[model samples]
Each structure stands twice: as structure tokens, then as C-alpha cells.
Target: MKKFRFALALALTAFVPQGFAQDVQPIDGIAAIVDEDVILQSELDRAVRNITTQYGDRADQLPPVPVLRRQVLERLILVQLQTARAKSTGVRVGEEEIDAALAAIARQNNLTPDQLRQQLAADGLSFSEFRASLSDELAIQRLRQRFAQSSIVVSDGEVDAALANQASGTQYQLANILVALPNGATPEQIATAQDKIDGIKALLDRGEMDFQAAAVRYSDGPNALEGGDLGWRSADEIPSAFTNVVGGMQAGQVIGPVRGPSGFQLLQLRDMRDAAGSGASQNVTQYQASHILVRGDDAAAKARIDALRARVGAGEDFAAVARDGSDDTVTSGQGGDLGWFVHEAFGPQFGDQVSALQDGEVSAPFRSQAGWHIVQRTGTRQTDVGAENRRNQMREMIGQRKLEDEWNRFLREMRSEAYIDIRPAAGVAGVTDGS
Candidate 1:
């Protein structure tokens, strides 16, 4: 139930620090051979250690050694499979991108880069190893985004219905434990998955096992080790399979062995609350802005935008310069007029640029997916866009749900197609079942 990108990031956190080093180390025993890649026994040991470190005093809550090993190995296999797929599809992470990601990670953890390096060293990790892990993660992230953009389309009618049918402001804090079934699972496999889920449910119902521990031991979900935490989700983001039930469930209630596209899942309503602004006024400050976009390779585009910014700063008319130089044909002809838009109407990059500027002020050039741009904030006004904004929110939520479903199916397919051979000798007991 975890979002694709965030889950991808979490899944590999334990494995990231020494992943690359394990790849070329021939002396270590192989835990699994994934396509052309091998997951080393040493890698599994470090991953397990990292998980225990993460749990700290709660390490007693972790599953038995065998179950934990399988969970960690499966995660590592999936990461390898995904990164391989990303490479096949031509996704690449640049040095600059990795540098930016490192900084962002440091900032998020409230540590400067140097302090972050020190922390990693204290944990016996090297910055280069971390960077290697992040490189694959970034590539896989880009791959997922590209897949979603290409495959998921949210129709206007679907958004309209979602907006009409949903409660205005409710959100649920949910956790899930999934027993995933492979694509086109056989009747026997389905029954096995169902039984496993049912057993998990009985344990939960009888209070024989806590939900988080059950998840860590048995759930095949990406967030299993995180106690299968799905965090807070709006009704729009809930799959239709569970939407009908989640709304009626009380806090702490568990629902399902509910079969879904991915597998049999058990969902727990950890908590529920009204969305902060559900019934609040939708009045928001709207920016009237315009920009000159320069599309090219990153370096060239940045250079061009910077030159345009300097020209404008030297008393060149912004509109005249935009008309002559902007790469966005639709707006360039109209002197790059973007007209009126709210914060994030054009995405966070554009919004951040415009929002940080005063009226009539020109911004420094900034980069976005669309390339580079220098925006001028012409004016600002408070406008209510409640109806439109709600529709947009529904569309995003629906698209996200659909993407998760599709992406999971894709992963299953990838696993089915891959040549994976998990060795019993790799500390996994007699289990040798590998796709």
C-alpha cells in the first residue's frame, strides 16, 4: 500500500550502504542469483543488522531469524530486478542529481553534508556506497514516473464521480499486510495466498500477534518491515476494493483477507480524521506570472536562462525578450504570458519561483522537468478555487491508486520473467523456491 517512489526508497535503505561493494566481491557466498546479478550472503547479514539497528530497543519485535532473512532477501531481489529494468529502459542518474539528492537527504535528517558523512561513518558506511545506492534509486524513481505518465490516465468523468461520491474531508491512517500473488497465479497459489492471509487475520483477531509483528513476519508488502505502514490516505486514494469498507470501520479495526489485483491484503484502520481544510474556505493567493522557458540539455538551458535573466535585470523588457527567446511556443507568441495561476498550478518549481518574488520582480533562472525558466511575478490576488482544486486533487489521488496497482503488477511480471535462484546454503534453511 506504500506509494511506489517512497516505498522504493525505503525498501533499499538497509541494503544501500554496501550494495555496490558486494556486487564484485567474489569470495562471499551468493544468497541469490538474480538474472546476471548475485546477492551476497554478506549483503544479507548487513541488511539484517541495519534493520535491527533501525528498530533499536524494539528489535525484540522483529520476526524470527528465518522469516526476517526471507523478507530482507526478497526486498534485495526486488531492488536488483527494478534497477536492472531501469537500466534496460535507459534511465540514468547524473553526478549532479546524486549530489542534490545527497544534500536533500542530509537536510531531511537535519544534518549538514559533513555531519551526514560522519553519521554514516559511525554506522560503518561510506559516502560513495550511499551514493551508489541512491543512484539506482534515482534511476528506478525516474523509471516509475515515466511508466506512470505513459500508462496511467485519469479521465475527467472518473474525477467528477470521485468528487461527487466521496466524503468531503475524511482521511484514514491505514496499515496493510499483503500476501502477494504472482501474475496469473494458479488456483493452488491463490488458495495458498488466501490461507496465509486468513491465518494472519485470525492471529490479529485473536490478539495472538500484533499487527506490526505480523506484518514483519509474513506480509510480502514493500513496507512490511515498517509494520506495513501505509500512512494517511484520503478516500480518493483508497482502492475501490476497500473504499466501501474503510469508511465504516472504527479506529483499530482490521479488515480483509480482501482479494485485490496484487494479492490478498489485510487492512487496519489505525486512525481516521477530517482533512485539515475539508470545510475551510478555499481562498488562496493566486499569482499572475509569465516566464521564458529555454529547453535544451541541462547545462546549455541553464546558461541560456541565466543570460536571459541578466538581460532582463539590465532593463531589457521582459516581454520583448520572452517573445524573441522563449522555447514555449504557446506562450512565447503572447510574450510568455502564463496568465493567472495558483500555487502549484504549474508545479512546485514554477510556484516556488513565482511565490518567492514580489510583484513586478523577475526571478533568477531555475530548473524544472520542462527545462529552465526565469519567471516574473506580475501581480497577486486571493481567489477561491475550491471546486477546481478538489477535482484536481481527486484526479491525482485516483491516478496514484491506479499507478500503484499497475506498478505492482509490473513488478510481479518482472519477477516471474527473471532467472532467480535463492540458495538454501545462504542461511535460508531448506527454502529454495525462486522464480
Candidate 2:
């Protein structure tokens, strides 16, 4: 069967179609040009409208129209650059992938595919247009994945050092506003950026404007429109230059105008959480479970799993029954003994089923991507995974930090090399030339 959902972090509201709604009357003019690609005025207008719709009651908190337009246009430009580069590098997303993503979106919003289409129609968006936009998003994601695989490498020594750094397992939820300076910025440009960042800091310090509001109005970062919310970061995940400074900050505290690869940034520590409590050991619960798998692609498979479930429910020896009926040749030969493994050893469905049962209790038949399964929980134990888990987490953290730095640099280089021209009619209000 086709996969029912995508693994992409696509939220219904957040996945607003990049294309215009069907009812947006066309304005016959080029808003901007990037290489051979041209952005139309109508597309810009629609993007602006979409952001306005997203903000709703908080729309009043948004920057003025001209500023918002410039922000949206820059985003569009980046998207175009990314998609074009992805295609040039042979990245492709098929129609089946787009269909699966659409189905996933529909399921997430509690709507059938037809209902989703109807809702899109009511909102003046065509289903086909939405599919195209989703395709671009998926392609760009795949491109990024490929880039991370090829460009970002975390060494074992780095992970070891991260583990050795005597720090507690604390994580911070952060937000930041960046006053960006161009690559190879002159003294005048640096002075101007410094002034802007200082002014923003002054506004935030006096509480004249909140961090989020100030971010929306003035930040030049990619997430400016989202109020510069960077989510959570562990000590290892933070940029090396700012780690010590951030570690010293308390919740609701703000710091910066600190210079980094991207620019001078104002950082805010919104909240913090202890990943593992102080002096607490990391332990994972493991389930000793066994399952009977009835593999097939049709109702016959479901019927077989149900019958096997009935046999076990009627007090037949589960191991004997599994040996006779289970299609998982590897485990079936061993009386279906799966051995002890962590909760996430198998997929979520298997873990949940096992976790829900008491020792020696069997679960109702369920389907997974593998096939239909009926699991029996044999026992459970808590195992300390502190050392192993910390090493793994540190490896991932180092990789993440590297990827962010590499990707930002890649984007800056791409933007600098691209041939871009913004028309006067595109409304460059409040935005400077060559900005």
C-alpha cells in the first residue's frame, strides 16, 4: 500500500501554498528577476496576503506593507534559488510523493482528500497549485538532506570532547534577531549594522517593544517574519562563539550585538529545561516482547492475523502458534523470542503495543508498514543508557551545528553570485539599494 503520510514536518497552517490563490487577479509585471527566473507582482501580492492571513488578530503587530513586501520577496527569491539549484543537482520529487504528502496534510487536518480540495476551493486555491508548491518544498528538503550528507561531518573526537565538557544536561529555548551585514562588508556597513542592532537592543531593554515584535519589525534573518523563534538548542548545538555567553543567561534575558558568521545578533533565552535532572542518571525502559507477523498486501493478511490472535486468545501456546503461523522466519524459528530491546527498538506501533500490555498479555492485531502484527509483552526492565545516549546526542549536536554554519554560508554565496534585479515598481520602500 502507498504510505499514508509523509515524515516531513508539514503543518496545515504553516504549509500555505507558495503559489497564488486562483482568485488573485494577475498583475502583468515582473516584480523581480533572479537569473532567468522572474517573480510576478501577483505572486508577491498573494504571498503578502497569506502572511497577513496567518497573523490574523496579530496582524496589527506586523511591519508596514512595504517592509513586509520586501521580506516576502526575499523569501521568494531564496526559494527560487533553492529549487533551481536542486533541479540542477538532479534532485527530483515524483507525483506519488506529492500525492502522499497531500494525503498526509489532509489526515493531519482531519479532512479527507476531497474535503481538503473543497476547503482549498473555498479559499480560492486550486488543488493542483497546492500540489506544485508542496512538490517544490519537498524537493528543497531533499536537496538540503543531500547537502547535509555530503557537506556536514561530525568527528568522533569532537563528540568525545563534547561529552567531556563538564556541563549538565541543560537545554535552552532561544529566539534571536539578526542585523545582517553583506559579505565583505565595508567599515561604513559594519557601523550601520552596529547602530541598527544597538537601537533594537535599546528598544527591547526599555520594554518599548517586545523581542518578538521588534524581530518582526527589524530583523533581517530568514525567520524574521516568524519573530526569530529558533526553538531549543543544547550547549553543543549552539554556535561555538556564543555558547559561553548563552550559558550565562537566565530565562527572559537578552544579550548581544555579538558578531558571528551571519551578522551581529541579539539573542534571547526564552526558557530552559533540564534534559536529565541534575545528578540524575539517564535510564531507558526496555520491553521483552515477541510478535507474530502475517505478511501480505490484502484482506487475507488481516484475516490470517485475526485468526492467529484468536488462537492465542483461546489459550493455545503462543510460541507454538507463532512458530506455526508467523511469517517472520528469523524469530518464528526461535519460538518468536524477540529478546530485550528499548521502547523505540521497533517502530512506534510495536513499541506502543508492547508498552500498553502487562507481562504475558497480547495485543490486538495491528498493521504497520511491515505488515500485520500481534505482540505479546513478556517483561520490562529499566536500563541505564547515560554514557551511550550522551555520546550519540553529542554526535548529533555537533553535526547539527556544522550543518547550520555550512548551509548559511552556502546561501550567502549563492545570493552573492546570483544576478538579481528588483524593479522600482516592486515597491522598495524602507529597503536600501543592494540590501
Candidate 3:
């Protein structure tokens, strides 16, 4: 069905049968380029129009047109830059990878791949052009992954630096919806739809309905059947329309029945916390720990943990104790050292438990559905200060700084770099209807 929809959309919009080139108005223009990749004015206009026309009405903090333009240009430049680097490094995003990404995008937007394609065309984007967009995104991901491997290590000193510059902060765990009215819907029709949704929300607010059940029944989202679960997204990950609601919300709270492009949306807050309230120091060395099976006998597991505790109490080397009596095979052979890890790499359940233990404090037996188990605090280091856990923040800043310092130096030394060309006829508008 998805494929058929896309094929149908393709047929109607940009398809040229029998291998003839799909026509685009040949506007002689090049907005920017990076080695083999180019960003055209057409792409720029499409992006802007998509943002302003499709998402703008639903936004409370819409960026001014000029600000939006500059951001779009910088991003386009970065895409080209990544393509140049990726090509040089012989990196490519395979078709399977592209298909997987496309599928994920469709799932996110509540459509099948073909349906998404048709929607894009309806909004004036060609499928071929959209494919190019996906290509650029994949290339950038590959390049960033490579760069991150060599450049993203956050040592204790680095974590300290991050903490020193850190200030108080907060964050939210939230999910949302953006409702866009159909092109031909009358004003009265739109209002009626919004009112209907709002009436349902009023019931939810007054405790007359279950949130997830209501969302599942009424939400027009891809995750609707799964109860509108967006899965632990950060405040920054939320669309600006509901940022304020998310940023300030407490756990189990909900907000909205708010105005949107197509109709009304209600945001639900799954959880929230003060970001800096926990005084736990981040400048701590992290060690990886893994445990293996000794399952199906709680009494026996407790006995083993008791014995291990006595051994360590008698001043035996902790690592030696692990090797001698522990069944956590991943660490037992290696003296219980899992590897170097940043604390948060462990999810909340494990992270909270480990964070509370001082170095060398063996944990009490805890029961998870998996089994009865013991956790040991092998070692600690001073690391992961403040927002260092914000994955992209450090590397992006480092990459930009590196470019500023060394790009010109490298350029001066490249004797065989190609000469750039500028043509008089290559100036024009992008591919949009003044979006």
C-alpha cells in the first residue's frame, strides 16, 4: 500500500516514464557547494516553505524569516562539507541503510514511505529531491560517526572542564502532536474538529479518562496505537510549540488542547526533574561491569552474594574475590572490570543504583525480573561533568573550532586544489512559491 501510494504520487507529480529525465524547471542557480555535493536555491526554498507553511502556524516561537534563512544556509553548507569529507574517506550510506532510515521517517510521521512521498509532492517537493536530502543526512551521519570516534573521548579532565563551566539547568520528558488542517477544510469545519478534540481533553483533564487510552483512541499519530508514547525524548527534542509546557512540567502532568495549524493538540508530561538538583559530582572515573547467569534459584544466589561479601570483608583483593567466587563471567575473568564507561551509558535503573554507591561498596542483592543479583562498585573516576552527557554538544563545538584554526592552514598548503568558478547567469530564487 505504501509503495503503491508513492508510485501513484510519483506518476501524478514528477514521474517521466521510460527513463526520460523527470523535469524540474531549469533555474540556473547554485546556493552553495561542498566538493561533490551542492545545495541549490531550490532545496533552500523548499525547506523554508516546508517549515513556515507546514509548521509555522503551529509554533509559538517561530524563528523570524531572516534567522531561519541563515540557519538553513549554515546547515546546507555543513551538509556539503560532510559529503566532501565522506567521499574522501570512501564512506557511503548503503541502500539498505537508506531504506531503513526512510522507513523510520515514515513511521515517525504517521505514514508509510509512499504516503510520505505523496505528501511531500503535494507540498511541492519532488521525490528525487527528497531522496537527495536523505542522502545528505546519511552522509553527514557517517562522517560525524567517524570524527566522533577519534575526537569525542571525555576524560576526567575534560569532564572537570565541562562541570566548571556548567550552570543550573532543568529538563523534561515529554510527548506531543502537531495538527495540521487539511487544504480544503472550511474554517467552521476546522473549528468543529478542534472543539471536539478539546472536549475529549477536558474529560482527560478532569480525570474522566486515562491518558494513554485516550491518546490511543483519538490521536492521529503514528504511535497512536501504542498510546502516543514518544519514548523519553528531551525538552530540546520537542517541537517549540510545546517547549514551555514540557520544560516546566512535573512528572505525570499534562498540558494543552492548544491551537495548532490543522486543529488542536494536547501535550502530556510523562516525567520531569530539576537538572542540577542532584548534588552528585560528575567528575568520577567510570568502570563498566557486567554480570552473567546464576539464575532460577534465589536462595542459592543469596548464598553466593553472602560468601562474596565475607571474602571482601576479610581483606581479599576485590578483583581476586570476583575471580574466585563471582559468576558474572564478563567481569569475573577480567577481575570484574567491564571497561571504561560514562555513567549514563547505563540506563536510569542501573545508573541510579550505581551512582549512589561509593567506590568499592558492593551492593546488596536486588531483585529484577531477570534474577536475584549483586552489583559491585569496582572503581570510580571523576568524569562526565554537567552537560558532557549531551552527546552532540562537545564534538560539534570541537569540530567547528578545529575548522576555524586549521582549515585555512590546510588550504594554503594544498597546491593542487581546483579553482572555483562563478558564472553571471547562476543567480536566482529557490524551488518554492515564496515559502
**Mind giving the per-residue lDDT tens digits that candidate 1 earns over 1-435?**
001122344335444435433233445778899999998888887777768767889988888888888888888888889999999988988999888887877777777878877776665555577778888888889988999999999999998887788766888999999998878789999999888899889999899999988988788898899899988999878876898889889999998888998899999999988786754558899889889999975677788888898899999999999998999999999899999988889998789889999999998888888888888999999987787777777888999999988998888888889999998756764257576
Candidate 1: C-alpha RMSD after superposition: 5.6
TM-score of each: 0.80, 0.77, 0.36
User: RMSD of each candidate?
Assistant: 5.6, 5.6, 17.3
> Ranking by TM-score, best first?
1, 2, 3
lDDT (C-alpha, whole model) for all candidates: 0.82, 0.83, 0.54
User: What ordering of candidates by lDDT runs from best to worst?
Assistant: 2, 1, 3
Q: Is candidate 1 or candidate 2 better by lDDT?
A: 2
For candidate 2, lDDT tens digit of each residue in 112-204? Answer: 999878887776776677788788888888888998999988888888777788488788998899988889999999999999999999999
* Winning candidate number (lDDT): 2
Q: In candidate 3, which residue ranges exceed 4 Å CA deviation?
A: 1-23, 29-78, 121-124, 161-274, 278-419, 426-435
For candidate 1, give the lDDT of residue 178: 92
Residue 54 shift from truth in candidate 2, angstroms = 2.7
Decoy 3 TM-score against native = 0.36
Model 2 score (lDDT):
0.83
- Angstrom error of the Cα, residue 76, model 2: value is 0.7
Off by over 4 Å in 2: 1-17, 20-22, 277-386, 430-435
Q: Which candidate, 1 or 3, would have the higher TM-score against the true structure?
A: 1
